[model samples]
Target: MKNIQVKWWLLLLLIISTTVSSCEKEDSGNAGRLTETDFMVAAANSDLFEIQTGQIASGKGTLSEVREFAQHLVMDHTTSSNELRILANQKKITLPDSLTEDNRAIRMRLSGQSGVAFDKDFIEVQITAHDEAISLYEQATREIQDPDIRNFATKTLPILQGHRDHAVMVKSKIDSF
Candidate 1:
């Protein structure tokens, strides 16, 4: 009776182990060809560009600070986007030339507003977008299967975090003003 119980316990453990390992394998994305990661990176880059251009072009907020943040976004995201472009090209992942419809619609909406209204709205969007981006980067840092893709996420995470922090600070001022 003791032997039977031990065997059953062992069998359960084996089943659980197999299940966990299989889930890990599937989550890693088929030997890390980077299809999903690349798509996400490309889309993120497009959104960054869309927001940067729109804000810089139509921004009415404390122009000095908005200009500073706009410049940083251009510099940091452009560099990261270029790295992503290189990786995508090497991995043969297709890259898009423009932002998706949803992001474009957001940019158009921001462009339509003016003065403090536009400033507040744009800052809020930046805060929300950076927060979302931080989470995405954090997940990619863990779940990305390819060494290269994982490294890119790791390298870019601090920069994204900084952007998020700056955005939050600016947002508070924009909101209060």
Candidate 2:
């Protein structure tokens, strides 16, 4: 009788442990899914970086082409940022109001440059930033579950691609000089 009781207790404990383990796995799976909030936060950060750097480039760039490209970045990213803000407000997700620490550092570094050096560095920065933005938007389009956010990502990818191509062109021009 005692042996049977011990066996039954062990079985109950084993079942409980297995059930608990399964529950943990399910919870983790849900946590791993890409959400709109995550995409928005990252998008907001990217827009902020673009806008700030563009502002600097517009003022400090030696070349008219570089200044024009900077102006374009500021205009487009400002519009994108405003739209993101509206979406974030609707979803009750507070988007970041400023650049990330790394971006702030980049801004500081760019601020210290002037003339042709500034234009070259600014174009390089834009190329790298737009590349990152394109990747983020592409990933969001593929992995995000929210229809609105996925649509936004899909729509924005082309713009990011355009910016990257323009940046590459600007880099070539700067290199030729």
Candidate 3:
């Protein structure tokens, strides 16, 4: 009788432990990502890095301009990514660090092009990326609940819009070529 009671208690404890462990695993999995707004920011920032990297590798632009522009991209995106990561951590939200499939497709297309073709594609994607960024940031500026986050969105929107303008100008010229 005592052995039977001991066996049942052990089984109950094991089941409870397993249930707790699984719940912990699930919670941790959900904790590492960003909220929707931050996620979109990170996604756009990732594309910025991708474009900079592709441009640097292609070496298509005037060497000085290419290097300077690449520096700006890397610094800007790195700061954005880090900020989003911090926010995600605080919010206990998981963010996708890798580019989405569509972004990846664009990256692959850019990788395949050379010289003027690469420059045109790069500028074109920059316009689209910044357009999306501005739209999303504009929405988030109004919608986000956190004061700091809302401010971040609001503050970043104009810079993104400016980039979009520059991209549009460059793309127009490239299209002419």
Candidate of highest lDDT? 2
Per-residue lDDT tens digits for candidate 2, residues 49-134, read 99999999989999999999999999999999998888788879989998999999999999999988999889988998998899
TM-score of each: 0.73, 0.91, 0.65
2 or 3, greater by TM-score: 2
Q: Model 3, 98-142: lDDT tens per residue?
A: 666777777777667667766766776666677777777777776
Candidate 3 at 15: error in angstroms? 45
Candidate number that wins on lDDT, 1 or 2: 2
Report the Cα lDDT for residue 81, model 3.
65
By summed lDDT, the worst window of 10 consecutive residues in model 2 runs over 30-39
Error of 3 at 96 (Å): 1.0
Q: Clashes in model 3: which pairs?
A: 32-94, 33-93, 33-94, 33-95, 34-94, 34-95
Error of 2 at 52 (Å): 1.2
Residue 27 shift from truth in candidate 3, angstroms:
26
Candidates ranked by TM-score: 2, 1, 3
Clashes of each: 0, 0, 6
Candidate 1 colliding pairs, count: 0
How large is the C-alpha RMSD of every model relative to the true structure?
6.2, 1.7, 8.9
Q: In model 3, where do residues sit more than 4 Å from their true spots?
A: 1-67, 172-176
